[model samples]
Target: MKKRNKFFTKKNGFICAFLAPGILLFLVIYAYPLVNIFATSFCRWNYKNFQAPEFLGWGHLFDNYIKMFTLDANFKMALINTVKWVVLTMVIQIPFTLLVALVLAKKPRGWKFTRNMFIIPNIISTAAIGLIFLNIYNPSRGIITEICNKINPGSNVSVLADGNYAFWGVTFAFILFGGSSCLLLLTQIFSIDPGIYEAAKVDGASAWQIDRKIILPLMRPMIGTVSIMAANYGLLLYNEIALITGGGPDNATFSLSYYIYRTALGSTKLNFARGNTAGVIQFILGILLVGCINKAFRTDQGD
Candidate 1:
């Protein structure tokens, strides 16, 4: 028994010591908040009861969850919009970013400049980007209005005034800012051994063939990684939406994060329980999203 204890202590003691700080931090920062949020989600809490949370009992524990889906219109819309954002990001933003990365990998003239320019938007604050888009979409003094007026003298189309246009306006505000995603993919492409490309060329493999068969296959894992990041970004979208639309045109552009914020702090009636419930749902949805993406892009060793 002493030998076994000594062996484990010698083998794992240093490793555990090294990991202790991080584990403690995780418990204090992440795990505790997550567990507390879930627990508080089942209680009745609001501004009135902010100091003390009342448990809903086992029988009515799911009332908050039920109310979110069936009672709250904003929550329903936020859920739909959040799902749409995730789907659009995975389908459009990721593919577009990959295409740019592939092109940049070819080292075309001015490619470095182009890549830097693409990343500039990401480096700048999302608030700034949102404000820039807001100006561009401005009906009175914006270029979009100018273009519309030029096309048909005296035409007025307010992008943020209508629900559909507001949604698309918000979408366009951040959809193309996949600079970080492109950079990640480009790094993956560059990490591949140059010898592989040389060998493929010797075999008369065209650029298209090399990319389709070799580069792309090898890049699946990185693509999966970037997809997960982008999907999460989309799911938790809030800053840009908050700055640009403010869930405007009658809450047409509400995201899950914004909805939570509105419920908890943004409104007169602060519902901490409902807000935390939304957060719990967001957390669970994020996990499911990551799982689905991993499953979809999972690499098979047999290949």
Candidate 2:
């Protein structure tokens, strides 16, 4: 029994060693900010209130969230935009990405060159993309305007300048941006047993049938991760929306993360506690959502 216990202990120690860097990374990069934000959210803080952070006992958090739910105009618009963004990304972006992945998986014409070129937009920074889009959406003599007017005389469709279009424009801004890699997801999807596909083909399955019945079900875990990633990215959205709309023609596109920045730095800058509250709220929501999605994915995979 002692020998067995010693062996198990050594194995557990080795496992923990492998996990240490990631655990420490989470602590330093994510956990500390979370704890700090949560604590700060419960207090009445100011620019110079760093020394003695007053504890307001959840009042600020609740009031801020209540304001988000009821009073705040920007919050409401942000919420609406967030929902739309999530839906569009999940319904359109993920499927589109998968389609691209599928095309790349097939050794089509110029496959190697095309795959490298297709993800080029992701290599460019979001700020650069935002600026590029801004130019493309400019009303007069811009690339988009020039092209549109050629098609229909005097057509001036300034997408980012208008409220309705701005929502969609921001949502689709990062549609091409992958996380600095040929999507780990694409690799995962491609790695799926080709034998199943061959078997399905032997059974006279159409391409659409293969995708619908086999690809989608097997790709559920990756899809779920991508969905959550889209939502979380949309929730924490800034930059492109800021550069494109800057909370918009009428605060029509203020996301939670952007609102936090505005609240912390705008005319209502004195409400540091409330700003912190928003950050803490975003943090909590992100954790809950990502955890739930990953859990669901695991359960689906287990089955």
Candidate 3:
């Protein structure tokens, strides 16, 4: 019995040794920061005139939560714009990509060349694209005006200057970014059984009917996956805002992620406690939102 016990103990020790590095890495990289943020969230501390943190359980969460609805109008705009960002990106991006992919999958020489060309914008970095748009939107001596000279050089349209146009301006890069999604969907379309189409044709089904009954239904799982991913990406909405208008003309473009970043890192507003509080809240919200999105798509994934 003593010998058997020693053997089992040695085996367990070997397993633990293998696991230790991964466990330690997780604690250092993810778990420790999470715990620290949770602890700091409730503390009353400011960085300007250094004050020792004093824990006031739930106080920071309560204050920020209240301010979101009451005193801060920017919070409300952020929430609204976030919804717009998610909905528009998903709604426009997926269906458009699917359509383009379908065309590419159809295998015309014309379509293949066009498909490659469309991805050029995506190859460019977001910063470069933002800068390009900024120049295009420039009032005088810009390409937009230069092009307009062909018709009438007198169009006073400075596209990015107005608040309403600026909102859509941030989204302009999104409309033509890449054929990445299209390429992904195209592969899936290619994998689908050709016999399915032959069978539909034998049944006297029209092309539209086959697409409606077969292709769209088959693509549901992929579309759901894409939509969820799009929503998550939208939550990290800062680059366009920072590059285009700097959330500007006013606080019109300030997204939640950008808001938290500015509050934490800003020279004027250096509240570490509040920043940690926001971080904690963001972590919770991210988990909840991703959970909900995954749950919504889980039904389609069983196949």
Candidate 4:
């Protein structure tokens, strides 16, 4: 019994030793920061109170939350824009990617080349893409100004200078590049058994019929997965807006992530508590979004 106990202890020790690094990494990288953010969000931590946070009394505990929804115009705009981004990604980006994936699955002429070309944008750094779009939107020497001049000579219209155009400009900068989403959909398409396609063909089904009747239903889970990814990207958008518009033209293009950055670090005031509060809200919204998506896509397997 003593020998058996020693052996079991040694085996457990070995297993724990292997798990310790991963557990420690998760605690340090994810859990600790999340707890700290939630804790700091209820405090009054700003540039003036940098070293430590002052706890808000119970009466004033909800001040930051109330301010974000009621008093802060910029936060309202950011929230609205973030919702637009999420909706646009779900409506436009995912469908476009799914369409492209369906087409590429057909393996037409130059399909391989087209697939590789489509992925180039996603492979390149987002910062590089943002810089490229910024130059393209420049009024002085960019192509857009040249095109405007062609249509109406001497017209120097800056795409990023006007609020309405600036919003769409930021949208177009990242909206059309759905290569990663396309890749995911294409993988799902190819994973379908060839026998299924052959069976559908034998049953007098056309390509479109096969896709609609069989492929789409089978691809629901994958679509939901990709939708979540794209939605999260839209919700947490920052880099493209930061690099391209800098939330300019009357702060028309601010996203939730950008709002957090501006509140916590970018602005002179450095309101860490407010930023963390936004972070908590963003986190809760993300959870709710995932839950809704999962429920929508859940399959009914009646036994």
List residue ranges in candidate 4 displaced over 4 A.
Answer: 1-8, 152-155, 299-303
Better of 2 and 3 by lDDT: 2
Cα error, candidate 4, residue 3 (Å): 13
Model 3 alpha-carbon drift over 4 Å, by segment: 1-18, 49-52, 57-61, 110-113, 117-120, 144-155, 299-303
Worst 10 residues of 3 by lDDT: 59-68
Tell me the alpha-carbon RMSD of every candidate.
3.3, 4.6, 3.4, 3.0
Descending-lDDT candidate ranking: 1, 4, 2, 3
Best by TM-score: 4
Clashing pairs in 1: none
Residue lDDT tens for model 1, 1-303 = 987878687559899989999999999999999998899999999999889999999999899999999999999999999999999998899999998999999999999999999999889988898999899999987787788788988768788898999999999998988998899999999999989888989989998888888999889988998899899999999998898889988999999999999999899999999999999999999989888888888943234
Model 2 residue 250 lDDT score: 87
lDDT of 3 by residue, 193-238 (tens): 9887889999899877877788777776666666666666676677
lDDT of 4 by residue, 70-143 (tens): 99888999999999999999999999988999999999998878888888888999999999999999987679
Residue-level lDDT for 35 in candidate 1: 94
Candidate 2 achieves a global lDDT of: 0.73
User: Which whole-number lDDT from 0 to 100 does residue 128 have in model 4?
Assistant: 94
Better of 1 and 4 by TM-score: 4
Q: Which ten residues in a row have the lowest lDDT in candidate 4?
A: 294-303
